[model samples]
Target: MNMVEHPGFVLWFTGLSGAGKTTIAVALEAQLRERGMRLERLDGDTVRQGLTRDLGFSKEDRDKNIERVTFVAKLLSRNNVAVLASFISPYIAHRDGVRAETTHFIEVFVDAPLEICAQRDVKGMYKKAFAGEIKNFTGVSDPYEPPINPEIHIHTDQETVDESVQRIVTWLEERQYIPAKVTA
Candidate 1:
């Protein structure tokens, strides 16, 4: 599987915290890797620990965060590396900026009700946000502007992870972004 034969693209997964953005991205990454694609997964939490460690959660800081990630994704995707990015990128403008900067950018909206996301919060961040302990939290103190038209929309509350991944993979194949899976 020569990666150069496959064009690079960026799969940007955006949703509320605890909405399974990272979970689905991880599953999709593994499936793509099994196909022998050159890939990289840029996660919000992980990137925050390194690349954007100096940034905070404010809107200005958040914009800066996405801008930095967009730069990295642009470089990787242009070089034939599949980029899987999962983030709680709440602003439409910021996401649009990424789409403009990256190559073959696909916006994947991981949709789930706020209540459902709150229930899935094992880290208690949502609880704190709801209680006013955590300030500037998207969907609580801050606003999360959902995508007007995402390339892929996954309902995390209704769909299983496998189902979501299959849907995404099928889309990529249909669009000729990725080759169809070869089964034995």
Candidate 2:
């Protein structure tokens, strides 16, 4: 298939829950939008409520959820719409499966320690997981395989949101995934 007029790619944000994937994704989406990029932000929780509503936390269901997201991302990218996907895609195989389908894939690992994430959890998922209320919870009951070699790694614990956004913008410019904006 022919490429879109403007380059479009998958900016995949993968990490543990409360690892700042959504925070970074939201800011990045805004910046990209300001730059006039046609894009979509497909967050895990939002997708779960809709497309993956029937899917549970089982590995099989998780895989199916990711597969659905990947399919949507592929469709958008093929039309030159960038995708900012934030998911706790803990399985390497699942992440790799999505990667294999995208033409321009940038895997970003939003790194944060489990303890820190737990401390910052507004949804109380970590608290519930620790209390045995939630099963198959990534980092609590499920496995979260970090990307072996992610294109970008955001240490969310150490960096402020602005700093992280700047880092990603720098990376995007360096890679020419997005056009560099001219300052007035």
Q: What is the C-alpha lDDT of each candidate?
A: 0.93, 0.90
User: Model 2, residue 78: displacement in angstroms?
Assistant: 1.4
Give the clashing residue pairs of candidate 1, or none: none
Q: Candidate 1: list runs displaced more than 4 Å.
A: 1-4
lDDT per residue as tens, model 1, 1-184: 6453578899999999999999999999989987878899999999999999999999899988999999999999999888999999999999999999989999999999999999988689999998999989999999999999999999998999999999999999898888666674
- What local lDDT score does residue 1 receive in model 2, on the 0 to 100 scale? 21
Using all chains and alpha carbons, the TM-scores for the candidates as numbered come to 0.96, 0.95
Best by lDDT: 1
Considering every candidate listed, which one attains the maximal TM-score? 1
